[model samples]
Target: MTAYEYKVVPAPAKGERARGIKGTEARFSHSLERVMNDMAADGWEYQRAETLPSDERSGLASTVTVWRNVLVFRRGKAGDVAAYQPRKLDAPKPYVLTTPLAEAVHDQQTATGTSDPDQPLAHPMNTLVALPVASTAPPETPRLGETPEVARTARVAATDNGVEETQDLHQMSSILRDRAARLIAAEQPGRS
Candidate 1:
């Protein structure tokens, strides 16, 4: 049997309770819970869980935040590994809204270098853009730029320099033919 190790953070306290507002706090808690449930549903068993303390500044705040971690494990036969794949959950779509105040603030900041130093640093918003989704089906053909013939030729050429020299001669002939074709095309343009 093949052993597979996985980690997951189970749903936090917020998800267990019916919270009126689905704010950032609720989302964070829900994310943790979803990860745990998803892993458990995939045959993974909980191995461990721990709470990570917040930094000194944050720890002293009125509402302290701590990281909740969970680890899970699973085992399967080598042949069964491929068939045990689970479907991935769809990512939440982004909603766009215009903010006149935000736009004005941004414009002012651009005009004057002076801005709120206490505010969080501006990050590249596009960094969070979702990557092109991939299909679950296995690829039908080898990936692009991967040629078995070229690979074999390269291997043979490396081991046998004499074969490489012969291959170079054939390549030279092809190059010469290409150059001749270009020259003929250039000359025929004048006739046209």
Candidate 2:
């Protein structure tokens, strides 16, 4: 279980010149709601949320006055029978926005002057993948002695040099399996 702090800051009112912008408040509200929903989905129960009083002495216009609200989420403790108790949640890491993987790969390939004939080309930024809001639990690790059949197949394929077709098929299958595993691992819980 963990504790997380989520904040909702009201968008500062725009100047009269910019008052006609569409969807500004709606977008901000949706973003804040999504953050809260995501935390709830991750097994974090809402502990508390409150708005702090705004200071009028700061000379800012009342319409533009900012109200700060905070939401604290906490996971329940484990059962009492456990041998070792889990530690409290650590401070969250700073958020750094990143390009989606496909876009990043495309950018890298373009920078390096290499192009793949098999893949369709598109703008890298257009493929950005938004992350899910809630954090998931970690995946269980595989046992040490559990060797998958694909490993054996790969070994056999490596020794058969005379059969080009079989080797090619095996290599492609191995590549696909590896890629799938990588994607699954990336999506697994406790990744943050």
Candidate 3:
């Protein structure tokens, strides 16, 4: 499990006032661009912002309702071994051909004066089907002094039953790259 530290601050105003009106605070969305830029410098990420309702009794028969925005910021706690600990990924076992066709092919190849045991058999009725065998080696680990960008690109796309997937930050590159290419092409001179 991952742990996080949270900070709650008053949401910035989109209108006239800066800190919002006291007591009867109006509903306004905070400018997250500024907050995110500032927080990103300090290694904090903006998770989400929430607006809560605060009700106060103005009189015996009247209740005043006020909505205030609460900006939430979170950062992963540092030095948490569990968060950074590498998950064990067991490699897939290689599959050996155990079908009757395979055995027959082997026998036929032997009878035909073929000495190579690894040679593929070509039969009319019993066409030998070769299934791809997965490697039995363990998953590759990041070497010392390796950058995060390199490590991210080297991870295999598949996962096993008992292992959990690591957090990936570079999955959107393909989509973003296509969009960027289209944008660049559109800006080029003289395209009617």
* lDDT leader: 3
Q: How many Å off is the CA of 122 in candidate 3?
A: 13
lDDT value for candidate 2? Answer: 0.59
- Candidate 3 per-residue lDDT, tens place, 5-78, comes to 98887777663335644332342323445666778799777878899999988979899998988778888898
> What is candidate 3's TM-score against the reference?
0.39
Report the C-alpha displacement of residue 89, candidate 2, in angstroms: 36
lDDT of each: 0.59, 0.59, 0.70
Clashing pairs in 1: 11-33
> What TM-score would every model get versus the actual structure?
0.22, 0.23, 0.39
* Candidate rank order under lDDT: 3, 2, 1
State the weakest 10-residue window (summed lDDT) of model 3: 21-30
RMSD of each: 30.7, 31.6, 28.0
Q: In model 3, state the lDDT of residue 50.
A: 95
Off by over 4 Å in 2: 1-22, 53-67, 79-192
Off by over 4 Å in 1: 17-37, 54-192
TM-score ranking from best to worst?
A: 3, 2, 1
